[model samples]
Target: MGASIPPPPPVITRSSDMDPHTLEQLRAVKEMLTAQEEEAQGLRDLNRDLRERLEDCETKIKKLNEQNDEYAEKEKVLSHRVAEKVRNNKQMSVVMEEYERTIS
Candidate 1:
């Protein structure tokens, strides 16, 4: 195999050697990165707030659901009582009708 070529000497360049356009591009990139970081932070804050609100909403929903369940149970009990009263009333009416017939 042929001998490997010797590595070239390191070239030392000053920061001033960078073109103005390249420097400007670097500055723009930095600014963009900073803006993105700020935006990300704001989004994180908003997300936290939304999460808190969501939790509050969920808690309220749970409480309401529990209340609804209690109301439903009460309604069932009331309906049963109402049905019993209707049956009693029907029975009383039948007795009254028979009594009226006998009297007439």
Candidate 2:
């Protein structure tokens, strides 16, 4: 195999050697980056607020769901009791009819 050629040394340019136009472009890029950082911080704050609100909403939803379950159970119990009362009333009416017929 042929020996690998070494890479050329990187040409180093000092900040003082940078042309005025290149320096201006660099300064513009730095300003843009600073603005982006500020915008990112604002987004982070907004995200934190939204997260807190979402958590609160979730908690409220959970509480409401639990309350709904409790109410459903209570309704079921009430419905069962009402049905039992209706059946008892029907039986009592049948008994009364039989008694009246015997009396006649």
Candidate 3:
């Protein structure tokens, strides 16, 4: 934890002050606290990893959107070119028809 839990109240200075059962209880409490600390650390690590992945995904999505925009622009340009070609072909056909009529 950010602020360590003080270290478990130090070992009993003398055996006379506390009974065996109390000492056992203290040891069990210490073990439980240690387990909780380890679990908390694991959760923190997992959170950090997930944040990194999310950032990576956001970057990829940005790049894909840029590519899609580029494709749309290219499609627009190509469509305009096709329309121009159709108009030009029609004008050519009209000119050829006039020439044929005059010759006949």
What does each candidate score in C-alpha RMSD? 3.7, 4.2, 8.4
Query: How high is each candidate's TM-score?
Result: 0.80, 0.72, 0.69
Candidate 3 lDDT by residue in tens digits, 33-93: 9999999999999999999999999999999999999999999999999999999999999
Tally clashing residue pairs in candidate 2: 0
Q: What is the Cα root-mean-square deviation between model 2 and the actual structure?
A: 4.2
Sort the predicted structures by lDDT, highest score first.
2, 1, 3
- Candidate order, TM-score descending: 1, 2, 3
User: What is candidate 2's TM-score against the reference?
Assistant: 0.72
- What is the C-alpha lDDT profile of model 2 across 24-96, one tens digit per residue? 9999999999999999999999999999999999999999999999999999999999999999999999999
- lDDT (tens digit, per residue) of candidate 1 on 40-94: 9999999999999999999999999999999999999999999999999999999
Q: Rate the local accuracy (lDDT) of all candidates.
A: 0.95, 0.96, 0.94
**In model 1, what are the clashing residue pairs, if there are any?**
none
The segments of candidate 3 whose C-alpha lies over 4 angstroms from its true place after superposition are 1-16, 97-104
Best by lDDT: 2
Instruction: List ranges where model 1 is wrong by over 4 Å.
Output: 1-18
